[model samples]
Target: MTIAVVWLEDDGLWCVSDTRISRRGQGGGVQIVTDAGAKIYPLNVECRLLTVERELYYGRRYGMVFAGMTAVATQTFATLSGMCQALQGASRQDIPSLRDVATLLSKLVELYVRDFRASTTLADPGVIEILLFGMCPVSRSYEIWRVSDQIVEGSLHVAIDQQPARTGDVVAIGSQVSRFQEILAELKQKTENTFRLPKIAVGQMADASRGDVGGAVSIGICNQFGFQTYWSLGLTPHGQGARLMFGVDLDDIGWVGPVVISGGGMA
Candidate 1:
């Protein structure tokens, strides 16, 4: 089984999940979605989960932190701790060094894969893939983390080269990425005014092969005053969901005060 989650906080965004990939009855966990439909019903996968109920830690932007655990507990904690350190050390800006964050995440994934191989776990386990997104200093970018369980074998995980377009980003996971994109495109084109994102949009982003759990996506605009008009799109094993929110960084708007936009357009 696998689990994933994305959270939006005042400071930034958070994404979390587990590495285990299991099928029905494999873990004795109930499927979150209904199985009624003439269309194909996506297979429900398992994941370690953390959310409002299983709170772990908290931050400024993110008031509550949750996750679903797997066998890779040590690896998960280490990776998260390392990410926090990197973020703390990173220079504060519009997009907080996304490449740097992605680099750190990749390193932690590799480290965990190596540790698992060295350990006497399940001999040879399959690899795991996770999709992560969060608010950065500039714009948001997605990171793909793949971990191979096969000992001394080829990579079980691979990062996608191109980032998906973020016209109206949503927080979601599942087998509905393509379908979700189609919906977003249609929404934007159909709107009479500028394609401004609603506060948040959530739904399932699935594909033909595998479904993602605890996945989330978000997008919108940040005006010159540092006010964020944002939306999130999320999808879990159960179904599609969305949330809308607006925020201003206390440090930017309160402490530093608003800045003037050079161009006439909103920042």
Candidate 2:
């Protein structure tokens, strides 16, 4: 299991995820592994193969953070990659809209479920949830769409729900979502919260049972400028030190500053 958190602030969209994977052992106990898993995948990128850390925030204006079964997540990434390749081959004017992308993702999950049911007798493929966040070129606003799939009557059911985030909206998914919500609420009640929001979210997940959700936390931001990594475990020690000391590298990642959403092209 994994924990992923996404929040919309005045600046842009912030996403965070923990890196831990678990499986059932021969004794029927769960075995937890860490430091070699990632749950965030940036969409709309130009790359032949997607590398979880390096390519996730590369040349992306949109991205998706996922939690749940790793097999389902891998299939979802493949579907998105294929869609992106198809879009790249089309005319600039033929690029799919954010809404269209969300629709396509839902359909892809539906198909995956169908195939899973055909090949296996498992009633469910495991819980799968995806949060799609990005800037809408047409509306000039940041939007978050929740895409989820569940097993219902031995078949997979998919749902797509979307909402335009106002400032201070927060969303989280995975096995530790309830804990995250509790932390957020407690922080809100405190007049002087010392912890960074993402850190707090990740910390709680890391403290869960047998540390099923423990590991380094990765973060990415998306806005009018584009998508870029705010923090990643894959970064070199030097890169991590630089960011901790001097915030984000605006020169390299492009700064959004305080953007006003107007119906226009990317800044």
Tens-digit lDDT track of model 1 for 30-58: 34332111110011111122433432232
Candidate 2 off by > 4 Å: 45-60, 88-92, 192-198, 207-211, 232-267
User: Considering every candidate listed, which one attains the maximal lDDT?
Assistant: 2
> Each model's TM-score?
0.37, 0.73
**Consecutive 10-residue window with the lowest summed lDDT within model 2:** 241-250
Model 1 spans with C-alpha error above 4 angstroms: 1-23, 27-78, 86-96, 114-153, 156-174, 185-267
Return the top candidate by TM-score.
2
Q: What residue pairs are clashing in model 2?
A: none
What TM-score does structure 2 among the candidates reach?
0.73
